[model samples]
Target: MMRSHRLFLIAMVAILATVLFRVPAKADYYGEPAELVDRATSVYKGFLADPNLEWFRNNVGSARGILIVPQMLRGGFIIGGSGGRGLLVAQDAATNKWSSPAFYSMGSVSVGFQIGADVSEIILLIMTDRGLDAMLSTDYKIGADVAIAAGPIGGSAKAQTADILAFGRSQGAYGGVSLEGAAISPLVDWNARYYGQPVQIFDILINQKWNNRQADSLRQLLPKPRRNAQPLGR
Candidate 1:
């Protein structure tokens, strides 16, 4: 009996060791910085141009920027798991150009027996003046710096619009359960250097540099924000 107990203890220790050294899941962004920039630019620029979304985009420069982390980032288990990553770019009050984007990643772990994978998108709203101020600091915690809300889906057109106005996300899945309480935190790259780049999301919409053909394609797709909110006034 004592021998059996000793063997059980050894097995348990081995299992715990495996879990401790578990490999991190890898994600594929397709090695496409241009694609990410283009997609993010479209989202930001589209929000700006849309008559409906302009007020929010205009305010984002002053509003705390949001970080959205997809749940179940890369896949693994050993190789089966879930989580996501996000980034934010803010404009300087004086420069009027985007600062190097602040990148962040968010995720969680579980103890229950579960497996499989899913895709999720995190949308964040930077709602308060203080929240924005906190993000600009060297590093910020998710709950510490910004208020977090776990978003839900489906509603009337007006309700949907209101939901979009706040932070929200869409999740897709496979397996026994879907995880929740999706949270986020800032990603720090100490070696990276950031300078304000002259690029503006506005440039994507109206810049004449694009051939008339491309310019028209972009303009037709991007509409000016309807609310026309001014910068936060003193």
Candidate 2:
């Protein structure tokens, strides 16, 4: 009887600790680091190649810099399981090289008992000068002071040729959800591993160093920007 009581106490303590302090498990899809890196790089290059992406990148290039979060976050019903990390690489305007990429994680909670997963790539283009400035700080909250908008639809890429811009918004899985109320921060550890260089999140995303690489890559992959031949203006 005493042993049973002691075991119950231990189980309770474990449950409390899990709830109070929990870090999402590291994402290692297919257990291949090189494959993951290649996947991420390809996704970014694909965006650069898309004609619509070219106009979007150009319009936002005027911002102090851009913040890109390539995400894959999953969650479900009663079990409440979730975990996925992403890389955010900033481009430098003067140097034309990509800054080391930073890491970030995504989390969500729900009640029902639905079990499913989504795999997608995402990028947040900081369009305004003010948007980049605020994010450069140690900690920034979305929707509080920053102005954000839903990213353009891949299908409507042609329709949005005019370079309409907005603050940081999400792309990828469960599309159309706003990241306005989300908490985004820079990842110090990831930058060190991926680039073999020390970097802070703000330095990569806000400063203009890596910005140039992104701009140049897009330009090379896409046609020069031009006005929309078929105006939806009317």
Candidate 3:
């Protein structure tokens, strides 16, 4: 009887330990910024590899900033939500150089006829100062703060003169994808973790605060700003 009781107690403790260990930590919820940067690099490379994205490649040179969401998940039975984390990089008008990435989270809730889920890679080209300014804010709504248009696909496609242009590469059959009411907010914790200190969006992007060697490769992937061309919204 004594032996059986001891065995039962041991099993209970073992089960409890397993359960506790399986639970993810809070930091795990937000991925490491370095890993996110590498993933963003791959996502951008994938975009460039797509023959249908020639228009994007051509017009990207004119963008004031670029936001890359490597993997955004969306699903719903009726009332659904979509959310994801991404990196945003801006171009310095004076020096024609790209800035360090600013981390952000985007989420939205919708009520409609939606059933299935889809995973997609999203890219937003900030076409004007207005669009870039809105993204630099602490929190901003997509369509309300800055106008967003679906990016044109294919070689001969021409993008419209909008504040922002959005492109998506979906993995599953989602009926439709929209950024109409989505909210974008800065991820301060992730930025702090990456930079080893608390930093503001303006400090990292505009003022050029800390620098990480890991970002050198990623910065090289961006389109170089034209020296003769004037900055947008000048």
Candidate 4:
């Protein structure tokens, strides 16, 4: 039991070090937030087209918002770590139109085991107003602020009360993941750079005016929601 606890602590430290030291040193406008928007668009399109993700496709009409993480890496016992940055866009309750994406980073140390590595593309569907509010906040803990669960794959799955439903497509020796205690925070600078002005999550998601032309294609992809929501994805 002590050994397991030690491993978890080590994992958290590695993740913290990487987020603190490695990310900001990048030149080129910190790798350009526009590039992330492009990647997010592709990821969203792929999920919609994937046949294996039937539940997501069928039930997406009920989601209040969607977050797309183009890549999430998990590896190593020592010189390795796990983290990913993503974007969130919510549907306007009044207009029923999708808003522009807001930049966010998500990280977790509790993915995979002591050995091996994996990479995944993840999509999260926010099911309620509370879930959407959490995403709009500067910082959010997955299972603490609201519940989150792995979205079902096949048809037999029933509805879920969780605030967020996560879907991941992974590859590598250690292939699966869980977001139970993951930390998510807004990428404030990235959001400013991406839109050519500083903006808050409320402006980007709720008021729905903080937008960029590059993201229009991505917003156009989301389905229109129903007047009523169902427990399944609503």
TM-score of each: 0.47, 0.55, 0.82, 0.81
TM-score of 3: 0.82
In order, the Cα lDDT scores of the candidates are 0.39, 0.46, 0.78, 0.76
Which segments of candidate 4 are over 4 A away from where they belong? 1-30, 78-80, 110-113, 172-177, 231-234
Better of 1 and 2 by TM-score: 2
How many pairs of residues in model 4 come into backbone collision?
Answer: 0
Off-target runs (Cα >4 Å) in candidate 2 are 1-23, 26-37, 49-64, 79-83, 91-100, 106-115, 154-175, 195-198, 202-234
Q: With candidate 4 superimposed using the best TM-score fit, by how many Å does residue 185's alpha carbon deviate from the native?
A: 0.3
Question: Which candidate, 2 or 3, would have the higher lDDT against the true structure?
Answer: 3
Candidate 3 per-residue C-alpha lDDT over 21-133 given as tens digits, one digit per residue, 9 for 90 to 100: 33212112445889889989998888877888887877787888899988776765545567788999888877778888989988777778666666678899888989988
Residue 152, model 4: lDDT of 70
For model 1, residues 63-153, the per-residue Cα lDDT tens digits are 3234433323533333334454555544333334333344455555555544444454444544445545554454454555344433222
The alpha-carbon lDDT assigned to residue 197 of candidate 2 equals 67
RMSD of each: 8.9, 7.3, 8.0, 6.2
Ranking by TM-score: 3, 4, 2, 1
Error of 3 at 66 (Å): 0.5
